[model samples]
Target: MQTPPPKSNCKSILTCLLVFLFFQVFTGTLDAQEWAKKMFATLEHDFGTVAKDSMQEFRFEFTNLYKEELHISAVRASCGCTIPTAEQDIVKTFEKGTILATYNTKAFAGARGATVTVTFDKPYFAEVQLQVNGFIRTDLAFSPASLAFGEFSLTDKPRMEFNVSHAGNTDWMITDVRSKNAYYEVEIIERTQLVNQVGYKMAVQLKGNIPVGYLQDDLIIVTNDVANQEIKLPVSGKVSAPVTLSPSSLLLGITSPETEINKRLILRADEPFTIESLTCDYPGVTFRTGSEAKKIHIVPVTFNAGLSPQKIQATITAKVNLNGEIILKCPLSATVE
Candidate 1:
């Protein structure tokens, strides 16, 4: 009986050992993928504490360890609080890429933990999340922190300028100026003492290359005034060319949220004119002309703020069939007034 040692018990032991070996082999196969051996900077970084309204950037470095060329398809951050910038969304061949996590310390205050996700073409990593942690100061403010010079034509080189004045202390200074995008140009005209005001005059200029739609971006003002934190200046405007229409902006006085209103603008010449096309900046708005005749042709523009905000702003772009090849655009600014 001792020699028997329970044949069933022996079979159970052998089965358990086989199952363990199978799992080891499966796991090893998965671990051999390109991303399994990838290396990253620390799993997380602490930027420490910064001013309430400041600008800061945290960059994470990573590399590929596979023998084959590693391809990175995209890099994404967890929140708008952190803006991720990289040389290329798609990393080619065997190379290195950086995820620049720019935290708008102004928008996010107190202790925060954000993540930046990197995606690869390889099936190995559905997504790789990088972490960032920091403390944002809660004692800071900005006046006229945002600027919006509503819609203008492409023919017009419009320049909108705004000021950043601090009240807490004079130790603060605008350390850097950055645009959410690069098509636009922003410069500090003079960081000088103008009329006893110790601040800088920021000149925001746009090239009008933005697609014919709602154009918006944020200009980050990095200031030493408060520990190099950032304050976001929202820059918004419409792009238009010179058109025959008069009084470009449309105003639908204090209408109810569910109310719809319409107005007409004449696009006509002394003799005759043909409207090649009429386009509106906002999809929620549109325009139409009758018969395409030149003599005082009425172009009706409609506004529907139903269940929408009381104020609506946009641009009307007109392409006229003329020999001059003019790019006529006009702003259609409307408010409660």
Candidate 2:
């Protein structure tokens, strides 16, 4: 089964930004006083020039790279233009958390910047500061804030329309709209322009065949502005399939031979479904399933290690009868020594 790409291996502007920050963040981590910075994926984000009331946001995700547990005491923003919140207060080894920064475009306009300071109190006492900078143009605005695709199914072709209004500049116009993902089409229609005001109607349509997963993407709006030419407009949605397994990737801790462990998982779908049978990709693994047909099913899995010491990597496939027949697989791993 296809999984979402990790923070390090992103497809968008992350590739370009990581190259420049990777060296700086790593080099700074070598310093004894700045060691905490190493855990973060990135230390900065530029929201670029956005329209008024755009409600832009960026997630500064971090992973615990050390052997000790990581704890976040507080997350604070330096300016009212941005608000920072901690997604998870405590993170285990190899686990992740985020310092979510939201840009307040409604109250603030032009030259918006903030310093997000994350305080750590457990396993270490340190603070990491992240930079967030963006320009909120008062001249430009969006009616609906974003292109909210909402939730749909695998067989849905959803579309949304938004309007862009610009005050003071009659020549202001959106030259082009661009998106990295090829699953959508954007149509720009020019609205009636006044002597000193401009407007545009943006219609976005998603194809029916988009892969099943959470779609968190953005569209780059190219404009004629000489200083700032690109505007970041976010698009978000989720596509549900016939069947899905929550926590598709399970992590089991260290284990030894003859040790058996039981874990529970959530199997879900839009419609009522029943698990016809369960199968495991590896030996010494079994599953306990129920017969009740429902929209959500609880599945218990058991894994017994072999006599030898090794790593356990397995996938559990469940034959589910929903609309007809659907296969759902969940990958799990553990370390046996």
Candidate 3:
């Protein structure tokens, strides 16, 4: 038989256990911090001098050197001036990921800075803080900051003009305009060159015969200022079809074999026109439209599923009389079982 320990001795033992647990928790937190430091390539970024209203981004790359998978649960910036994003959260052993931090130059002007904190919850709990610093000069300004072309016909050429001014140096000249898009034509004219101010008139033209879809592009204005050489202007608009189709793609969902699926489509135009003909490439797909010409017309389309399970894909072409023969296409698809 063994003698039992005294109550005081038991209490001492329990206290020692608690202290050891505390030590483990504290050391774990320290180890996590150390791991984060070793994983990141760099912890700080200085953007030097950046142009106002220009979009800028920095990538903080890291690799999971440990054998275990590393998960980044959350990435957040201290202020709205900076937005942080992770390319991927889970990184396997020896894999890499990037933390993208974008600075909002439009909302934040004249000396902006923020701290981004990245938190990891898996493999081990850890947190890494990154610092970014930059200065935005107030000397350059744009009247509209951005360009919007609104809605335009594909056959019609559209043009827009805006002004850029510099209050710092009078000799600040726009040396060149650069755009990768072949459809855009840009022209810059010096509006005024005073003792303490300089101004330029910028004209952007969208050529006719551009592809029918949305237009989102940027024009880079290269200037004589060495510190801030390139300035970006955003251009956005939609190039609309003269003859538009609502629900451009007809979806019949899922249907049983030999069943019929009926759907309605709306065809519209800015001006009144007549739909000369409508046809579908698929064997069992058909459409019917009214004979009268109008700005808007509704057509009822039907799809007949054969006696088998199959996937359907077809193009519906509409010939319309608007100035000339305008051909509009709508895609049709369905699954039959």
Candidate 1 per-residue C-alpha lDDT over 265-290 given as tens digits, one digit per residue, 9 for 90 to 100 = 77655556578777876666777765
> How many backbone overlaps does candidate 2 show?
0
Residue 160, model 2: Cα distance from true site in angstroms: 0.9
Supply candidate 3's per-residue lDDT for 118. 95
lDDT of 3 at 122: 82
> In every candidate, how many clashes are there?
17, 0, 0
Q: Which residue pairs show backbone clashes in model 2? A: none
| Residues 137-254 of candidate 2: C-alpha lDDT, one tens digit per residue | 8888887887777788755678888888878768777888887888788898657798788888878888754656667677888888777788888777877776788887677767
Estimated TM-score per prediction? Answer: 0.36, 0.67, 0.46
Alpha-carbon runs more than 4 Å astray in model 1: 1-43, 73-80, 83-87, 123-129, 141-337
